[model samples]
Target: MKSLVSSEIVEPYAQALMSVAKTHNLADRFGDEVRALVSALEGSADLSQFLANPFIKVADKKAVLQRIVGDESHPFLRNFLMLLVDKGRILFIEGIGKQYLALLRELNQTVLAEVVSAVELNDAQKESVKQRVQNITGARSVDLQTTIDPDLIGGVIIKVGSQIIDASLRGQLRRIGVRLAA
Candidate 1:
């Protein structure tokens, strides 16, 4: 599959970046930078397409990166961006950033939990979800990402890695329907 190949290419680049972050004792800083870069890529389809366009010149891509990252970014990260451009692997930036963040989470013993609810959760509810995730994964901490989906009607769904714990009212109704049919 395309994703299999992407992962193959992405892992090494992410690990290499992680190695550099560890060497500089800037794992957290690099993680933040990667998150920001990924956010930017996701926020702008044109920018993402521009970086991935094979017809675009490398210098142009590098210039765009320089402009986006600016001179304030660490020299290592700036060089890393240039290296990706030079190697014609800029298309994998999003995947590489995600993989790098995953690696950082592993190193830090934290789990990323995606929570979907019918309504926005308050601080107390978020803390409760975090505690539940920590209990489920046995991680020292949980990075909670919350989203609202009103179709759920009520309750919440928690996803950590491949695991999904669906407590939504719709899920419950579906299960009940299946049970009655069976």
Candidate 2:
């Protein structure tokens, strides 16, 4: 129920931010700023708690945001941050930023692929995985996020959305074991 309420608050704010980004042709810039803001919020429990504190004055919150965003931030985003402060929605900024990025990826026809392999992939291997993901998802671009998992023994596992492509050695062995058991 709390998650449902949070999403209800998050989605409209994210959509509103996306609408502004689209209107000003600043989607990429806004996405970058939002990502940075979300990173800050996540990295600093103090900052997150400060923003969420009801006793904190709105002016102080805005001032902190200004310092964090710097003076050169676009007026629209500056105003957006101020609006969040005023509405007491600043606490949800991280969720809003994440949702906005998801919307941006959708707009750009990009897919995020989480790839786990037994070893670090070289550029060539990374590109191959990305190209394969593109072919599978029909996305214009693929945002390949890679991780190393030695337990896989060899090969890679590609996960996109709810689909999982397990090309790893351990997965193959598990499948073979299942077949033998049957």
- TM per candidate comes to 0.93, 0.83
List the pairs of residues colliding in candidate 2. Answer: none
- Stretches off by above 4 angstroms in model 2 are 118-122, 147-153
Model 1 alpha-carbon miss at residue 25, Å = 0.5
Task: Please write out the lDDT profile of model 1 over residues 76-132, one tens digit for every residue.
Answer: 998999999999999999999999999999999999999999999999999999999
| Candidate lDDT values, in order | 0.94, 0.93
Clash-forming residue pairs, model 1: none
- Where is model 2 poorest over a 10-residue stretch in terms of lDDT? 30-39
Predicted candidate 2 versus true structure: per-residue lDDT over 11-96, tens digit per residue: 99999999999998999899788878888988899999999999999999999999999988888999999999999999888899
